[model samples]
Target: MKSNKRIILHYDMDAFYASVEIRDRPNLRGKPVIVGTSVITTCNYEARKYGLHSAMSVAKARGLCPNGIYLKVDKEKYSRVSKQIKNLVLRLTNKVEFIALDEGFVEITDIIKSYLSYEVFAEKFKRGIFKNTGLTCSIGIGYNKLSAKLASDAKKPGGVTFIKDIGEFADFISDKGVKLIPGIGKKTQEILGLKNIVQVSDVLKISLQELRSILGYNRGEMIYEYCRGIDNRKVSSESKTHSISNERTYLSPLEDKEFIWSEFLNLLVKTHKRLKIQKFHTKTLTLKVRYLDRKIITKSKSMNITTQNIETLKKLMLELFEEIDLEKKIKLLGINLGNLSENKEYQLSFKNIENIKKERKIQELKEKINNFRKNIV
Candidate 1:
């Protein structure tokens, strides 16, 4: 059976924070604008031309471009503008998925009648965003989510690119770095680099068994398919939260085992309280540890039964920590509870019935004595 051709549109705002700053303060337009302190969260096209990009250090950015305009992030202002953009896109279709704050995927396959209609909608959407927020965006239309995302990336700042077929999608990403493929991050890059696999084409040429050995089972299998331009994910409008987490970063990296254990336990207790407040029960616990050199390792374990019990959660977290196996100083540590569901009433077990009966008898005796004292008075 043949599959229906999908019309997924990937929308990404152009240098979102920096662009918003430039829009409000028109004088900053042609200058190199940086939108963060301590770290470069984003930069304008002028800054990018000077080899400054997001996540670069402020000192390094200044060294690279001495005349760059640095502005603190106004999260409230940006959030309001983001809402305007999201509303504009939602008017076209309800099938949308958000990425971070500025990027989104809209599945317009059901609403659009033909390719001509898709083009028309794209132009109108771009015009609407600029008119309302004074910001420009890049849009990509493709047969699937991955292609759409790559297509948008290919054409930045007020450009639109389309990948209508699988052949076009494969050709577009063939020479690109493996990092460009979704979900292939720095750790995967490090592992694949050791095998001399640096490009998407390299991933395409590697055997399944070899890839599995390097990236473990699930992620390896998925990337093997992604290299060939295949992505089956839907553009869901509302994806439920699978987990909740809390983390702490140390001012200095921790080297002592005792300090690390204490910190881990503290974070776990905070996370558990949050889980209870949210009325959620989880079967899986995940521990995230970032090392001194910025490399992060995560380990998770699943329980035989779901629970919200503090003691049970603590026990599971300790077991998950054992899987880390690294003895290095840690820069950051986090606890995450996953495989979640709403909390339900606990059922009584035969072992606990005797305890409940004894508690009831004690309550009755106390009430009777109080009544006798009242009558004597």
Candidate 2:
């Protein structure tokens, strides 16, 4: 419905990791495939037909879809493709917030249903992706980010979901599970289960005070409002980089140099992808380690050049992670990129005046480079 507030769009890459896998291996297009390491990242809709989905136990997933194929995650490839997708979206709106590796919220202040009609956005985005690197995305449009996300998720596989009026909110969420709201984890769901809170109406039936008593004040208030489809958070356009990082707590703590090397590679690749997509370069790379006792250690290194190159990042990460003793149970590891600069502006300033002129010219060139991904990823 019409509102004076911001028009937020939630865009999600449908089964992103799986979609990318299918893009690379065309033969897997209609097949069921799961991408993950120790857990299932997500299974294709085809796999879903056999009762497969993200976070499903691997053994159960295998039992559910005996014919499905499983692929180990390729962080480098996924990160590269994800960057391409982000580049496409950034071209649409300067104000965006990434909520996950594969999902984001775009605030359309200057443009809305007119410039970015749900239909046009979907077709253009899907086309752009297909033409550029052969991938797809699903988009949701609403007056708010949360609603838009629900809209996008209502459909599957390169579809557009949108709501035109706030009056539709009740009907929209009527059938949704209470767990659909953010912050309602499995544990919360179990508690709600005891209260017979399986649906939105179930939450709506409870008073704010009672809900607050169970879910804590802040979270309870959010749930009450969300159940009634009310949100006031703004979609900010000036979301400059404050921090960018990639982290993983191990399935098991091990000191094998080879294993650490591999994990470091994974974290760096993911972090670098985030850096490139944001169009920001960083001079300081921080390495983080969490010991078994939860003691944290961090190391920082400065680079003469800011980059997103995988090989360079991998080498840097290796050197940084190597400083830690493997004998200690390192349960968690991460790579952080800070000391930010706009990759373009930083490069130009480091060079001469002529290069500054060249840099201005290259802004268009960079836009051209991402033009293909600008539509689809």
Pick out the ten consecutive residues of candidate 1 with the lowest summed lDDT.
Answer: 343-352
Worst 10 residues of 2 by lDDT: 343-352
Give a tens-digit lDDT track for model 2, residues 1-377. 34566677787877889988988889998899898766798878898899888887788888888888999989888888878777877887678887667888888645655654657766775687668767667888787777887888888777887775577778888888887887788998988899888998799888999999888899889888887778887776566776799888777886787887778777877788878888877778888888888999998887666665667766776677767777888889888888888856444344556665687899988897799787877
> What tens digits encode model 1's per-residue C-alpha lDDT throughout 1-377?
13577878898999999999999899997999999867899999999999999889889999999999999889889999999899888887788998767999999887666546667878877899899888999999889998899889987988999888789988898999999988899998998999999999999888988888899899998898888878999888887778989888776878887678788899888888878888988889999999998999998888655789989988887787677755787888998999988857545567567776888899999999999999999
Any runs in candidate 2 off by more than 4 Å, and if so which? 1-3, 57-60, 113-122, 238-377
lDDT of each: 0.87, 0.79
Candidate 1, superposed: residue stretches over 4 Å from native = 1-3, 114-117, 243-377
